[model samples]
Target: MIHVAIIGQGLVALHFEVGLEKLKNNEIPDYGVPLRNWLPYKYDDIEIVASYDVDESKVGKTVYELAKRDYPGNHIPGSLKDIVVSRGIHLNSMKGLPFKARGREEDKGIEAAINELVDEWRSLNIDVLINIMTTEPVEPVGNAGEIERRALNGDLTASQTYAYAATLYSAKYRPVAFVNAIPSPIANDPGFIKLCSERRCVVFGDDGSTGATPFTADLLEHMYERNRKVIDIAQFNIGGNTDFLALNLPERNIMKKKTKSAIVEDILGYDAPNYIRPTGYLEPLGDKKFVAMIVEYYSFGEFKDEFYVVMRINDSPALAGLLVDLSRIGRIALDRQAYGSIYEVNAFYMKRPGPPGSKAVSKYHAFQGLLNWLGISDPRMQQARR
Candidate 1:
C-alpha cells in the first residue's frame, strides 16, 4: 500500500480523503453527482495514512471527526470514521487569516508552532506533502533596500513559510512532492523552483481548479472552428468564503487576477473585454461560487451573436478529487525517480498553470504523458472524451 500524508486539514484535504476512500473500495458507483464525478482516477492501492492541521479544534481528531464536526458542507454520501488528524506545526502562514479556534491560548504566535511541525514532518516518514493552505499576495516591500531589510529581519508571511517548508523537506526527506493547491508564489517563484530542483523534490501547481474557463475556451474554440467573428468576452466571479475574502484584499489577489486573465488571453490569442476577476464577497454563499460569463461576436453581416453562461459550484469539492489525484501522482513521480515540477499533471489539472504567457494543454494529453512515463494506464482516460 502507498502511504500518503496530507499537510493541510482544510476543504481540499477533506476532498482528498473522500477520494482516497473511494479508491480503496475499488468500485465507483455513480451517485449522479455533477462536478464531483469529474475526478479521473480511483486507485485501490493508495491510502491516506496521516494528516496534519494546526487548528486546535481539528488536531488529535479522526478523519470521521473532521468530516462530521469541521466540514458540514461536504455531501460525500457516507460516514468517515477511520481517518485521524494529528497536530500540525502552526506557521506564520495562518496569521491575519480569519479562522475559528477552540481555546484562547491556541491563538498565539506561529514561529514555534511551525518549527515543531517541521520536526514532526521529518520524523513521521510522510511520503507526500500537499500544501493546501490559503495563499496571500506578496506585498511590495517598496524597493530592493526595503526587501533586503525585511529579509534580514525574517518577516514571516504565507509565501515565505511555504518556501521554508519546501526547502526544509528537500534537505531531509526522500524527494517529497509538494503540491501548491492555492495561488501561492512558492510554486511560481524562481528561487523556490530552483530549490526544489536542486533538492530533487517535485513541485506542482500555483492554482487548483477552473470552474468556467475550460467551458469558455471550448466555446471560443467552437466559434473559431465555425469561422465566426469574435469580438469581446466578459467573465465575473462571486463567492462567500475565504477565497472571496482573499480576492477582496488587493494584496492577496494580484497573482490570482493575472492567472485567471492569462487563461483566456493565452487560449484566444487576443484580449477580450474580459472582466475576469472576483466581483464581490457574499456571506450567504459560504464556500459556494457563482461565475457568469458573456461572449459577444460579429458573425453574419450586421448580426451580433452573444452567448451567456452561468456556473454555480461548491469550490472546495470541485477541486478535491483533482487534488487527491495530484498527491497520488506526486508519490508516483517520486517512486519513478522523477524530479522538478510535474508539468504534465499540473498543466492538465491546474487552473493557472506554468509560467505566465504559456498556452494551456488539454488534461487528456497530460494524463496520457504521465501514464506513459509511469507505465500505468488509467481506465477513465482511455474512455471517450467528455
Candidate 2:
C-alpha cells in the first residue's frame, strides 16, 4: 500500500480523498476518474496518511469534514474522519488573495518547521508527498546555492520548504516522492532537481496537465505530425476555483502562462505566435472551468484553416485522477530506487515536466510511454486491439 501525504488540503486533495474513499468501499463511479490501472496497483492500494494546509478554517478539521463540507452530496468514508489537517508554511502563496493564510513557521523557526514535517513524515510513514498548493509568484531560483541561500533567510516559497523537508525526511529515513501539481517550478528548478537526486527522493511536476493544457498539447502534436504550418494558437481557461483566484495576480499568472506556453515550441520544433494561459477567474464557474481554444494553421497551398472550440470540465477531479497515478508511480519508483524525476511519467501527466526542455508527446503516446516506464501493459489498449 502507498501511504500518501498532501501539502495542500484544497479541492484537488479533497477530491482525491473522496475518490479513494469511494474506491475503498468498492463504489466506483462510471465517469470522472479517467485513468483505469494506476498500474500494478488499484485505487484501494492508496492511503492518505497525513495532510497540511495554511487555511485557518481548514486546519484542525478532519479530512472527512473538509470533504463533506465542500462536497456534501458525496459519501466520505468514516476512516478519513480521523485524519486531522496540520498547519503548513504559507510563504507568499497567499499574497493578493482574499483569504489570510497562516503557517506554523510564524510561531516556530524555519529549522523547527522542517523538523516538524520530517517528524510527521517519519511518524506517518509517508511514501509520497503530493503538493497541490495554490500557485505562488516565485522568482525562479535556478541553482542549489541559491535555494540554500534563500531557504536560510526564509525567503523560499511554501512549496520549496515542503520539498526541502521531504528531501531531508527521505535522506534520514526512507525514500519518498514529491509530486508537485502547481506551477511553482520545483521539479524544473535545477536546484531542487540536484537536491532530490542527492537526497534519494523522486520528484515529478512543475505543473499538473489537465483540462485545456493537455488537450492543446495533443492538438499541437497533431498539427506537427500532419506537417501543417501552424500560424498561431490561442488557448485559455477561466475558473472559479481558488487557484484561478490566486492567478489573478499578474506575477502568479505569468508563471502559469510560462508552463502553458512552453509546449508549443517544444512540440512544433519552433515557436509560433501564440497566447496560451489562464485568462480569468469566474467564481460562479467553481471547479468547472470554461475552456476555449482557437488554432489557425496553413493547410494545402497556403489555405488558412481555423479551428475553434469551447467546453467546460471539472478542473479539480482531472488533477486528482492524475495525482492518483503519480502517487502509485512514485511508490513504484521508490521500490526501484529511481531517484530524481521520471520524465516518462511527467511527459504524460504534467504540462511542463521536470528535467526541463523535454518535448511534449501526444496523450496516447505519453500514456504508452508511462506504461512502459512502469513495466506494465495497458489492459485497455490490449482489449481495444482484440
Highest TM-score scorer: 2
Count the clashes in each prediction.
Answer: 2, 0
TM-score of each: 0.78, 0.96
For residues 140-194, could you state the per-residue lDDT of candidate 2 as single tens digits? Answer: 5878777877776788989988888888899999999999989888888888888
Q: Model 2 residue 164 lDDT? A: 81
Q: Mind sharing the TM-score for model 1?
A: 0.78
List clashing residue pairs in candidate 1: 63-83, 64-80
Q: Which residues of candidate 2, in runs, are more than 4 Å off?
A: 30-35, 380-386
Looking at model 1, residue 82 earns an lDDT score of 60
Question: What would the TM-score be for candidate 2 when compared with the true structure?
Answer: 0.96
